[model samples]
Target chain A: MTTTDPSSTTPPPDRRPGGRTARTRAKVLDAVIAQLGEHGFDGLTTDTVAARAGVHRTTVYRRWGDVGGLLADVLDAAGDDDWIPPDTGSLEGDLCGLNEEIQTALTAQPPVMMALIASSFRSEPAADAQQRLWEDRYTRCGIIIDRAVKRGELPPGTNARQLLVTATAPVYHQLVLLRTPVDPELPSRAARTAALAASAGAFTEG
Target chain B: MTTTDPSSTTPPPDRRPGGRTARTRAKVLDAVIAQLGEHGFDGLTTDTVAARAGVHRTTVYRRWGDVGGLLADVLDAAGDDDWIPPDTGSLEGDLCGLNEEIQTALTAQPPVMMALIASSFRSEPAADAQQRLWEDRYTRCGIIIDRAVKRGELPPGTNARQLLVTATAPVYHQLVLLRTPVDPELPSRAARTAALAASAGAFTEG
Candidate 1:
């Protein structure tokens, strides 16, 4: 028996069948992403989303309650379907992989990201969703730092959240604030700089 | 002759006496800020701003042209009125001062900052203002890093923009993205971390 590569063998999460309920969820969420990209948070309405999704308006209202609920579900679905943290035997490798994943996501769907960011600032539900997403990502990325610490690659008591945030903040700043191009070298540079800082205990709480 | 402290002697920019033209400009800009804070960019309209400012609608239309123009003026006024980068004799002190200034501005008027950020994403004029604002700050803070290099404190050719961005990005991430409380110690920690990274050539372009 031979082990198969998960990437090669596994069906895309949305493509895998779970019957009618899953199909409806996939359709609704896809419509939500499309609408968000087209109209941003301000212009998005449940009626529009329901119409676009070809689902009943009452079903959208009853299920999601409001724009915020719908947004939260969209965010949850966005995070749920992809990109588990990789364990690549070294902190640098893991962090680089994580940064690459981020770069890919941001590049692949910039408009959706822009909408999500705008929503986070203006809408309470969206803000909550954004917070939960960051917190969840931070918790998952903690394993990379923990592995590094165990291998004596980083100092003990390293602040994983700080490290991960520091590594990724520049990328977000570039994408969202500065509107600068995120060059190919950026992810590795960010990861390397963060790894260096962590090794020197810059992220350790005093 | 004894020298008086500049801060004590200098009238605040907004309070300084000027003619009717200056006063009118100030009034309009103040209204822009208020409208931005209250309504954000999407909701802000030049007519509403003119109404709020108690100026003639035609005057606003002639002066600012549109909502984006008003927002650009607001951002310019916001950046122009306050927070000159400090020359605190050392890189760490200067960086800390810079971060504290940012924290102060963000805390002092969160709604205005949020409005500016939102506008930057949606409007071209606002995005230009945002870009100019960051470029100006980065250039001003470059003096800090240059001084450090001259004093043999940091390595030569260190990228000032990178250092300042890295030091500040986490704070912005907390405020804008994470919606987390920026603790009192965060400024100093960010400064220290950037300083450490700068020393290690993390910010030096290859």
Candidate 2:
């Protein structure tokens, strides 16, 4: 994470991906995600994470500070992955594809995504990182709306973020909030609903 | 708060609303909600709740047992309220009204609902209690779809739960998950989108 303090005279040196420091960081962050998946936020401890990553406990404390720091770094690492929204010719197809990806992640054994979401509420740093990650995702998915508009499937002024939120909210609500049993048809059905609403200008910016 | 142990032959007496036991239960539960809104789950303790309720700490521990137990009872208490869905003549109006109610609750000072939601992730008892509360609310809200169907606004065999989830998910997603600045227009817009989709048969039973 970049230091936010403007008073710092000397900048921290950048560690290349192959460097020992970078490798250690990766190991620790990977362990954090795995640990969070296995044990929800309450069970996550720096000592356990350090043990899992084969790092010294003192080093873990000196580096990450606490569980919140570990969680924030894990989320920041996730944002580093080069992920782009799907392009399936039609907006509904793309949305369905995106929802399927979310479903898979949220419904994974010992679901890491759901665990992280739950942890964010307890950790301000993690919550901030997640917000940034969500914004990045929203921006990337804006292309779906742009393409739909060009294809004459949606209004030119349709709010991309709103439409995308409408399209995807049902999946998150079902899996994370309600903890309901998975419905095989929800992904396509929700996608179709959003697409229909968008085509009817329900998501058009006022 | 009903005991699940079948081995216990003695049945607990039902305490009337005006009874001392009932009053103490109400006070303690109210304190839990207040403390949650003020200090969040991490700040909540049996001592603090007991002090706030003017009840003894030992009594609280003996009755509610723990934080999870207190949270569970609070949710169970909320379910006792007689809340019915809006009876607006138009489906859009009713949905919009319901959305407004959700928006108000989610956006309240200190945001008790958001605190409870976050706390549930950390407590199994609270999660189970919340599930029951959600199911009850969903069942009660089913009347919205029935009224809409009878009014010819929505098609027959429309899945009430699916439609309601689609309509309300965006508000929770934006407010709780993203923690975004309030968009005053979102509640009505989301309701409008869902209403349009339902009218188009996007939420029809498969």
Question: Top model by TM-score, which number?
Answer: 2
Question: Per-residue CA lDDT of candidate 2, range B1-206, in tens?
Answer: 34345576554444644556898998999899899999999889999999999999999999999999999999998999989999989889988899899889999998799899988898999999988998898889999999999999999999999999999999989998988999899889999999999999988866
Estimate every model's Cα lDDT from 0 to 1. Answer: 0.81, 0.90
What is candidate 1's TM-score against the reference?
0.87
Model 2 deviation from the true structure expressed as Cα RMSD, one decimal place: 5.8
Q: List the residue pairs that clash in candidate 1.
A: none
Per-prediction DockQ: 0.56, 0.74
Runs in model 2 lying further than 4 Å from the true structure: A1-14, B1-14
Off by over 4 Å in 1: A1-19, B1-19, B79-83
Scanning candidate 2 chain B in windows of ten residues, the lowest lDDT window is B10-19
Model 1 chain B poorest ten-residue lDDT run: B11-20
Candidate with best lDDT: 2
DockQ of candidate 2 (2 decimals): 0.74
Q: How many residue-pair clashes does candidate 2 contain?
A: 0
